[model samples]
Structures are given as structure tokens and as C-alpha cells.
Target: MSDKKIEAEVRQFTVSADDDGIRLDRWFKRNLPDASFNLVSRWARTGQLRVNGKRATPGDRVETGQIVRVPPAETPPPTAAAKPKVERPTLTEDEIAFVNEIVIHRDPAAIVVNKPPGLATQGGTKTHTHLDGLLDGLADDAGNRPKLVHRLDKDTSGVLLLARSARAASFFSKSFSGRTARKVYWALVIGVPDIKDGYIDLPIAKQPGTGGEKMHVDEEEGLAARTRYRIVERAGNSTAWVELQPLTGRTHQLRVHMAAIGHPIVGDGKYGGQDAFLTGSISRKLHLHARRLRIDHPDGGQIDVTAELPDHFAESMAYLGFDPADGDLPLDEIKFSETAEGKRRAAEAAAKSRRKERKGERRSRGNGSEGGRSNSGGGRSKR
Candidate 1:
């Protein structure tokens, strides 16, 4: 047989600091935007793509400074370049107008937008219009589409960052992964916090039965979660304006933590039930707003931005005796991270609680022998 023909040229790329903690598939999407989602997945499963020379799965997380090898995407043969490049999909007129309206700041590396509430960052079921879908409108003449480096809840409005290129995306992703991105959020709570400035250390986990979007505090069966909050203003005893800085990124951490402390975030019906609504002048819209964001830029500078409150949030603030100009609160002083050991200890405590519950169940059972066996200490009867 003749010598085997050559395959696609394999290329190696070193993951930058900003690209940390991203899934392999996401990495491909950021770096090779032209490649189909299925194509990158196929390369991973077939061993054409790899991490550090070893075969890896698509869902595998790639850390900062790691090397990822990608096989050449299927392209036309050598003479293909002679043909003109095909046109890219254009954004709808509405999307173009929307992108233009939300853009607060833009540069070579990133575009910062004041994302409005009720707009989902990424698309989902029944979500036809989303920020990410419309980001294509911001693409340059070269067809380099902007990418979302982070996300915000659908009902939470404020400063949202988008990376204009793969390099910038990596930079911002690393900033979030390394905990260097300082985020401050403002919320009008149902009740006043007794302590003006304090920390809420609670373990949060997914609720037992429901969609994965739900998060609840479970001492034993949860991940470590912590939030630092300061009372910005008090609207008498009924409600208060609070500024919160989350130390850990857990699903619904803020909503659950505030609820656990007996002061649920105003308008958060999912956690506070009927109590979420404040009847009178206060609107029933969730009062959470991502007020400000500060992070390092990819090109060796810093980006600090503040977003104006949404209409509902501003109205609630005014109604609740909060001044929109009270921006002097300290935001970035706290340095906190929940260690792996702490989370492990919390999980152990939950496991211990489960074991004790099982023992109690055994004791409560009608079977005397099972109850005795579970509750009994030493085998022999003590004198």
C-alpha cells in the first residue's frame, strides 16, 4: 500500500488566564466561532481535539494556562481561497437598534452595556429575544462576533460586560474565575436588617425537587455560600435598602440567603412566597440591580463602570427613603473566598445530620428490635 495520506494539521493553543474554568466546548466557541457546535463536539469525542496531549470530553473544564490542541476544521482545498468569502448572517434591524441603545462603553477589547431587566443574557425555552443573540449586531466588519463573558439573571438588570474578541473573552473569564471581578448589587429588602454591616455565611444547594434554577440553604447537603451586605438606607421598620457583595457564585445565593435571614429580597416571589409583594406603593417587580462592576482589562488597564437603576428599582428606592445619589458606600474592601475544606466540612456536617436522622427514624419505628439495635450503645447491658 502507498504511504498513508496526511490528516488535518493539529494546532496547539495555550489557555490564557482569562480563559480559566470554561468548558472545552465553550473554549471552541470562543476561539473558533465559525466551527459548528456539533463539529467541535465531534472533534472532542473522536480524539481530534485534546487538552495537554490527552483526549478529553466536551464538558471537561479547561483551566487557565492549560494547553489545548485543536485539529484543523474542515475547509476547502488549497484553491478554495481563490473564491470569495461568503457573507455572514446579518442582524435584524430591531437587534441593531437595540444593541446601539444599550451600549454604554466600547473599545477594542470589550463592549459594556447597561442590560435592562427582563432581558435574558442567553436564549432558552420561549426566549426568542436575548442579549447574546443580539450581540451579533456589534460584530465588526471582519465578522468577529462579540461574546458574553458572564451572565445575569433575566429579571436582574445592570452593568453587563461583553468581550469583543476571543482574547478579551479569555481575559474577563479569568478575572471572574480568579475572583478579581468585584461586583456590587443593590436590592430593596422586605425588612430591615438588625445589623447594618455584616456577613451571611450560609451553605446553599439545589432544592430537592424542582428545576435546577432553585437554590436553598442546607447545612449538610450544600455548597459553601457567603454574602457581605450593608444597609444602605432604611424605609422605617418595614423595608430597607441593602447593598450586597457575593463571595461565592451559587445559583440564587442572594435570594436564598436573604430569605434565610428573614428579610427576603423584595419582589422575589420564588423564595419569599406571598411575602415577596409589598402591596402599597411598592411595585411587585424584583428590586435587585447589579449596580456596578470593576475588573482588569486584557490590555493592561482597569475597567470600572456603574449602571443606573431600572425604573422599578429607582422607584422603589425613592419610595423606600433611599437616595439614588448615595454612592459612597465601600464596595471592594472585602476579600473573601470559601475554601474547599470549608465546603467539605459543610458536606460532612450534612452527611452527619442525615445519619442522625436515619437513627432517629429507626428509633421511632414500631419494630422494637430495630429501635434497640440503633439506639443501643455497648453490646452488653450495663450494671
Candidate 2:
């Protein structure tokens, strides 16, 4: 067979002394903006990358002031790309105020915001206002709309991370999927657990239901989940301050595991408990909060971010006699405009009215009219 040969364009660069023993992939990524680690390693494996004109491996140590040559492979032609048309939603006066208040830590890589309860991370069919929808308005710089790398339950408020770019999103997503990203949560449960500082190794499975899919702990046919918890304080006979670290990223893993151990979250309605609803014991809102996260930086470093507890969570802490500022918890300012507060109050009033209506029906039935509206008085039983 005739030998097919293609000439390679060799590019050379001298390594600085400071980068004496850095990984070859890292060094190439720093120098070549378009080349990724996979490309570098592939070229190295094919003897296309050399040190001092000798074939080199991707893991070879580079001494200071050594010349490295990378042979250029056949580069693919750039494909036609379209600029994404981003639709920025208009925020209400209250939403603008809320967005201005909740941002705790922000950088070019990621943004950590204090997500208030009742705000969904993404939008649904009936959801008009959501965190992702409002991100373009909350960005620090123009044309840098942030996007969520992960999610939090609508009722479970606290720290939420948003990636600034698609690159950052991919990097952070990998970090979370690999379990290298550290996530910590603060919660107030119904009762104190038996173990103060230990792990709950359980499995969670999606419960078979019609309305909304909820999670339940099923040891037999469920995915393995783990949560490490520690008791921060004991609050009366019914509530306890707790910190949780989820080892696996399952849907509702923490909520299901805590409820499975006889101590449900203060305001989780899906699980079986009296205090599940917001109108129950916890009056304010759900007690779960994502407090902190630690992640690797895309620029060869690590970043530690913390989001403060919301006002309602702080109120719960006060009710439990604990200081919110006792530790390094970041405090964020939240200002609910009068218009927003009015809407919220109206919603609550409507919910209360509906509950009263249901209660009235139950009481009316107690007055001895339960037998299908009494056929003696009805001409033809409306059916």
C-alpha cells in the first residue's frame, strides 16, 4: 500500500521557570486557547507533541526553559453559528428590589445568591416569575446573564450558584456530578435525631403518584443515598437545629431521609407529618436552607461561597433562641416593596379563605345533613 503522509505545522513555546512541574495538559490549555486537554493528550499520544524535538507523553515533566513543539493537526472548518436571542423578562418593582437585595457573592465565574422561599429555580407552565427568568436583569455586567448550574426546591431557600458562561456551567456541572463540589445545608427538623454527628445511608425512590412526583425512602428498590448530619442545637421537644451534607445528589434525598428517621422537616407537606404545611407549626415557610458551597475555580484555584439565611429562616432561628450571626454566615439585605408585600398578603388571604370554605363545608355536614342532601326536602335530588 502507498504511504499517505500529511505534513504538520510545528509550533514551539518556551516554559517559564515558575511553571516547572505543572501538568502538560494545563500548560497547553494556558497557552493554546482553542485546544482542550483532550486534544493535547491525543496529540501527545500520536507523537505530535515533542520536547526538544523528541516525542513526549502528556504526563512528561517539563523543566524550566525547555522548548516544546506541538504539531498542528488538520483543523476543522468553523461551522455557521447563530447568536442566541435571549428574552429578558420584565421584573415587578418588588422583584427588582428583591433581586437587588439577595445577591451575596458574585464573580466572573459564578454568582451565589440567597434564594428566598417561594421562588422557583426554573419556570413551569404556570410559573411566570422565576430565578432563571430574572437572571439577565441581576447580572453584574452587561451581556453576562447568569444561569443556574444546579437547583434548589422551590420552598427550600438559601444559597444558589449561577454560572456566568457556558464554559463555567460545564465545569461546575462536572464538579457537582462528580461529587467534588461541597454543599452544606441548615435545617430545623421536628425532633432531634439519635446520632448527633453521623451519616444516614439510605436509598430513595420516586413514589408512585398522580399529581406531582414525590420521593420516598425505599430500601429495597431505590438508589443509594447518603447524608451526614450534625445537631447544632436542641429547640424544645419538637424542633432541633441541624446541619446536613448530602453525599449523593438524589431528588429530595435530604427531605426523604430526614422524614424517614421520624423527624420530618418543619414544613415539608409531601411527607407524612402534621407540620408539613406552612399553615402548620412553622407558620413562616419551609425550614430547609442551602447554606454554603465550595467548588473548584476554572482558573486553577478553589472558591468558597456562602449565602445567608433568609429573614423567615432568621426568625425561626430567633424563635429557637440561636443567633444567626454567631458564625461566619453571610447576611444579605432583603426589602419587600409595599406593592409586593400587598400581593403576598393577598395570596395568603385567598389561601386562608379557601381553607375557611372547606372548614365551613365540614361543619355544615356535622349538622345532620350528610345523607345526600335529604331526599324529603329535595323534589328530585339534583343528580
Top of the candidates by TM-score: 1
Candidate 2 clashing pairs, residues 3+ apart or interchain: none
For candidate 2, report its TM-score.
0.60
Measured with C-alpha atoms, the lDDT of residue 115 in candidate 1 is 92
lDDT for position 306 in model 2: 75
| RMSD (CA, Å), each prediction | 11.3, 26.0
Off by over 4 Å in 1: 1-90, 335-383
TM-score of each: 0.71, 0.60
Q: Which digits, one per residue and each the tens of the lDDT, describe model 1 over residues 266-371?
A: 9999999999789778889888888888889899888888889889888877776678788548654544235333354578799999999999988778587766
The per-candidate count of clashes, in order, stands at 3, 0
What local lDDT does model 1 show for residue 157?
91
